[model samples]
Target: MDAYSGYNQIFMHPEDQAHTSFITDRGLYCYKVMPFGLKNAGATYQRLVNHLFAPLIGNTMEVYVDDMLVKSRTADQHIPNLSAMFTILKQYKMRLNPTKCAFGVASGKFLGFMISQRGIEANPEKIQAILDMTIPKTVKDIQSLTGRVAALTRFISKATDRCAPFFKALKGTKRNITWTAECETAFSELKEYMGRAPLLSTPEHGDILVVYLSVSASAVSSVLIRSKDNAEHPVHYVSKALQDAEVRYPDIEKLAFSLVVSARRLRPYFQAHTIHVLTNQPLRQVLQKPETSGRLVKWAIELGEFDIHYKPRPVMRGQAVADFLSEFTESQASAATQHITEPNPPLSQDQTPTKNTLDLTQPLWTLFVDGSSNAQGCGAGLVLVSPDKVALEYALRFNFQASNNEAEYEALLAGLRLAKEMDARQIQIFRDSQLVVHQVNQDFTAKDASMTAYLQHTRHLLATFHAHTIKQVPRSENSHADALARLASALEQGMGRHIHIEFLAQPSTQAPLICTIDHSPTWMDPILQFLQNQTLPANPAEARRVRHRSARYLIINGSLYKRGFSLPYLRCLTPEEGHYVLREIHEGICDPASKRLAPRQPRLLPCRRKTHFRGARHLLKLSAAKPNLQDTCRHHNGLHKVPHWNFVQSSHFHFPINKEQYLGKTKNHSPTFTVTLPELLLVTDLGIGERSAGTTPVSEA
Candidate 1:
C-alpha cells in the first residue's frame, strides 16, 4: 500500500498555518495541508502513519511513511492485513494511489535493494552500471567505478582489495594516468565479480553470526555470516585499505586491525548479536595478553561492550568465506576448540573509579628514571615495572641540545609515557635528579619557561593515572637507570658501538608542529606570471630574466624548485645557486644525490689524491672515450667525488658502465680510473683518441 500525496495528507494546525502563508498571483494564502518542501512534512506524515498503523506494524504490516507493506504468513491472512491497513487510511482521510499500490504480493522492492523470501539481492540496474562500464582511462572513471562498487559492497567480498589497483592508479599524477597491467587484471576481475555478486542474507533474530577475517599487506577484509540449517550465508562484507603506518603493522596486529575495522563498520550488527570472530591465529591471546601495549589494549577495550567471542575458524563453510581462508607462513591450526573466550573487560577511561566509591588500593607501578648530560651527550633512560613485576626498560638519546635538568625532565616524561602505554592505573616514580622530582611534586618552582611547559605536560599525563607519586632517589640508589642514561648519552656521541640507538629529534614534553608557509609574491611568482599570463615586471631586464628563469624551474603546487632528471627539486638553494645547478646537470658536472655537489663544492674533498691510502680507492666517471665502461667495484664505500655518476646509474643508454663501476673494490685486480672534475668534464666533451690521453688507469703512473 502507498499513501498518495503523503505529505499533503498531513494537515497543518489551523492557527500555526498562518506562518506558512505565501503570496501567489491570484491571492495570498496559507497551506491547510502540509506542503512537500516544508522541513517537517515528511516527519509529520511519518508520525501520522506510525500512529494510525501502530497495531499492524511489525506483525502483518511494515510501514515506512508513505510506502506501506501489508505482509502475512498465509494467503488467508493477507486480506485481513490489507483491510486493517485500508481502514486506518480511510479513518485518517488519506488516499492511496491505485497506480502505485500493489496488494497480495510475495516479494517487492523496498529500498534500493530487492526484497523477497529468498534474500536481499543487489539492484539489477546498479550491477548493470558496473558491467556496462568500459576500462577506466582517467581518475573520474576509476572514481565512478569505485562509487558503483561501494553501493553494493555488501555483495562484493574483499571489495577494497579487489579495487586497490584502481585506487593506486588514481593516486598517480592526476593530469596523465599510467594505467599498468595490474589495473587491467583488477578491472576485469571486478566486472566478473559484480556479474555474479552474492545475495547478502538477512540475519534472523536470536541467530548467532560469524565473522571471518582476512589480512593482506595492503588491505584488511572480513565477511559477516549467518548460519541457517547448517549452511552459512554472508550478511555483510567489510574491507578497508591499510593506510600509512597500518601497512607496517605485524601480521597478528594486522589481524587485530581488521577486527577493529570490522567492529567499527558493523557496530550495529555487533550490538545486536553475539558475534564470534573466527580466526586461526592467537588473536584472543595477542589482544588479551598482559604484555599487550597501549595500541592493542585500546582496541580490546573498545570491543568490551559487545559479547564478541574468538574461535578457531572452521573449514570453509560457504563460497562467500573462501576468500577468508588463507595459505601462508602464518600457521592456521589452533587447538580443537569451538569457543576460546576473552577475559572480562578491563577498566577503560570511560569507567571513572573514585578512591572513595571504588577501593583504589591496588599496587601502583614502579618507575626508575634517570637523565645524563655530561661531556658525552644528552640522554634519558627509564625502567617501568608493572605491579606484576614485568620490567620495561627504555632509553632516549636527544639530537638537539638539552641541559642536565632538562634531560632529567625528559627522563621523567619518558617514564610516564611508557607507564601509560602499559595501562598503569597508578604509579610511583623514583628519579635520581632532585630538581625533577621536586618540580613534579610541586616542592620546587619551575622558573624557566621550558621547565614550566614541561611541568604542565607532566601534570596532564599524570592526571590520567588514578594515583601517582614521585620521589627523589640518591644517584647510587638509581644506579641501573643512571647507567642506562649514561649508555644512551654515550651512544649519542657514537661511542656505544653496539645495538640500535634511536635519537630523539625533539623533547618528550613538546610535539613538533608542521606549519606550511603560503608565501605571497614568492620567487616563482614573477616567473609564473611571465609563463602563464605573459605578464612580467615592468623592467625589460627583469622581465627577460623572469622569462628565462621560468624555463629551468616549474611551479608545482605553489613552491619554487629546480627541476631536472639529474637533480632533486632544489628548494633549499637560492636562485643564483639554482641557476648554477641547471648548468651543472645539463653540462656534464652534476652529482645530484650528493648535497656537497654545490657550485663551489664547499665541503668536498680536494681533487688531489690523499697519499695516506695510495692506490686503495678511485672515483670513476664516464669518459668521452669509453663507450662500454666495464668497471667493477667490490668496495664502493671508499670511492667518492666523481660528477655525472648519478646520470650514468639512472640512464641505461649512458655508457655501459658495469655494476663494478659503482661497487668497485680495493682488493680486486679490476682496473680503476681516477679523474678530476675538470678532467672528467673534458673527457665528456671530447671523445678519447687514445686511452692514455683521455682516460688514466689508477694502476698506472
Candidate 2:
C-alpha cells in the first residue's frame, strides 16, 4: 500500500520551517510538514514506517520508502497479515491512498516486477516494451534497445551474448549504423526470447540453489537454479562480456570469472542459502590449490564467504536448465573403456618392441603435440584424439618468452593436462621433439637444469594416468600440431577460429607466488562481525549500543563503509593505514616558498602543542609566519648556533618526547646553542635513518 501524501505525513519542527520557506506572489510560504523533493524526506518516512512495523517487516511485510507489501504464505493468513499492518497504520494515524493500494489479491505489481503465487516474473509492460520495438537504425536507437534489454537481463539467459552485436555496432564514431544481418538476427532472437520470458523462482529458506556456469569465446554466463519436485527452476541468469585483458583468460579462468560475477550480482541469495555449483570443470581443485594463478586466488577468497559446494553436473532435468546446458559444448575425450581398434604398424620382426610402442590389447587415447618459438611469439599446440576418433584440439600462446625446447615441453605438458581434464585413463603421447621424447622415455639424460625440471613435471603428470607411452614422431607426421602451434604463435587476437586458443601468462614449470594475508584485528572488526554475522557483545547494554550503531554502517565486498547525511559513503580504514595516509600528506611535494619558509619559521611547527618531526623522509613544508626565525639562529664560537631545536626540546609541552628542565628567568639569560645551524644537526642525531635522510634536507647537513 502507498502512503497518502507520504512526504506530507511527517510534520516539520516549527523553528525549522523557515529554512524550507519559499516566497510566493503575495507572501512567503513555509512547509510545516515534510515536503516532497527534500533530501532525506524518503528516509524520514521509511524510518517512521520501520518504527511502526518493526515486528512484521521481514515476516509478513516489506517496505521500500513509501511502498509497502504485505505478503502471506496462504490465503488463510492473508487477512491476519493485513490486519497486523493496518493496526500499526491506525495507531500512527497513517493514511493510505485508496487509488494506489490493493488488498486481498493473489498477485500484483511491486517495484516493476510481477509478483504472484507462481513466483516473481518480468513485468508485462517491460516485455511489451521490447516486443514492440522496431529495428534500430541509429546509434541512439541501438543504445535504447540495449538499455531495455539490460532492464530484463535476469529473465534472459546469456543476455550479454545476445546483445553483443549491438555493443559492437556502438563502437567508433558513427551517426548511422549499417544494421547488418547479424544485428537483425540477434534482434529477432532477443524479441523471440523475451516473448516467452521464463518465470523466476524465489527460493525459500533451507532450499539449496544450484548454479550452472557457461563460458564462450567472448562472454561468460551462469544461471542460478532451484531444484524442487524433480524439476529445476531458474532463480537468475548472469552474463558478462569480456573486456581487454579478460578476453585473454584461459577457458578455466573464464569459468571461474563467471562464478565470481554471479556471486557478486547475487550476493543476497548466496548469503541466505547454500549454493551448489554444478560443472564438469575442475573448478574446486583449481580454487582450493594453494599454488594457482593470482586472480583465481583472489576469486576464491571473494567466494569464501558463502557456503558453496562443488559437484559434477548431472543430466538436464528441466527445460530451462537444459537451455543453459546446451549453451556450451564440453570438450571431453572419448571414454577409455572403448573396444581396442586396429593395432599400430609393427616395427621389423627382428627388432624388439620398445616401451614407446602402443599395446594393441588396450584402448589408448592418442596425443600429438608440437611447439613453435620464433621472433613473433612462443606457443604450443596439442591434439587429444579419443579411442573413437573424436579429436579435442587445443592451442596455447605463452605470454612469457620461452626457448624451443621449453616450448616443446610446454606442448607435452599441455597435452597431458588436457587428457587429465578429459578423464582419459591411458594415453599415447607423440611429440616432434626427439630430445623431449627420449628424455621422458629414459633413452636420453636431461643435463640442463630447465630440461630436468620439465622432465620431472612431465613424469609427475604421467603418473596420474593408468598407463602412458611417449615417442618422437617426424615433423612431417606431426603436421597438424605443428600448424596449430604456428597459428597460435603468429596470429593476432580477435581472429575467430574453431580451434580454442588460450594464453598462458607464465611457464608451467614456474611455481605460483605464495602470498600471506594479514587478518589482525582492526576497528572495523567488531562492526563487521555484528553487521555480517549478527554477533554482539555479551553485555546487554553493549549489545544494545552495537545494534543502534550498526544502523549507520554497512559492509560491502568485505569492507566497512559509513553512511552520512550529505557526504558520500567513505571507506573505513585501520589505524596503521590511516597513519600511512597522514604521513604521506605531511611529507608530500610542496612549492619552493614552503621549503624556504620552513627553516625560518620554527614557530609554525608548534601550534597549540608541539609537533614532532621524527623519522621524516621529506623536507617539511612550513606555512609562512609573521615572526622571523633568524633571531633563533645566531653565530657563536665560529659556529652557527641553531636554537630552534633547543627551544622545541626544552618547551614543557605535552607531546611525544620529554621536556628539558626549565631554568629560573634571568635578565641576561640567552639560549645555550652548542650545535651548529646545519652541520651539527646530523640525520643520525635526529633519529632519521641514513636511508630516509638521503631524501630529506638533513642529508645535506
Residues 467-575 of candidate 1 have per-residue lDDT tens digits of 6677777888898888888888877353645544567898876777999866444456676665345476888567556644554554443555554444455553444
lDDT of residue 181 for candidate 2: 86
Looking at model 1, residue 239 earns an lDDT score of: 86
Q: List the residue pairs that clash in candidate 2.
A: none
TM-score of 2: 0.51
Candidate 2 residue lDDT tens string, 1-701: 88889889899999999999999899999999999888888788888888889999989999988889999999999999998888999898999999999888989999889999899899999899999999988898999999999999899989998998888889846786777789999999999999889999989989999999887768889999998898899999998998999988766677788899999999999888878999776777666443346687567667766767778888877767755664353431122113112222323433332454446666689999999999999999888899899988889999989999999999999998888767676788888898898788888999999998898888777766666788777899999999999999997868888878999999898999999878577656767777667577788566555554655566554677665445366677765565444333333332212333333322222222233232121212321231222222111112322333433343564222532333322112444322333354333332111143444343423
Quote each prediction's TM-score. Answer: 0.46, 0.51
Deviation of model 1 at 591, angstroms: 75
Q: lDDT for model 2, on a 0 to 1 scale?
A: 0.75
Model 1 spans > 4 angstroms off = 14-30, 37-47, 173-175, 242-254, 285-302, 327-701
C-alpha RMSD between model 2 and the true structure: 18.5
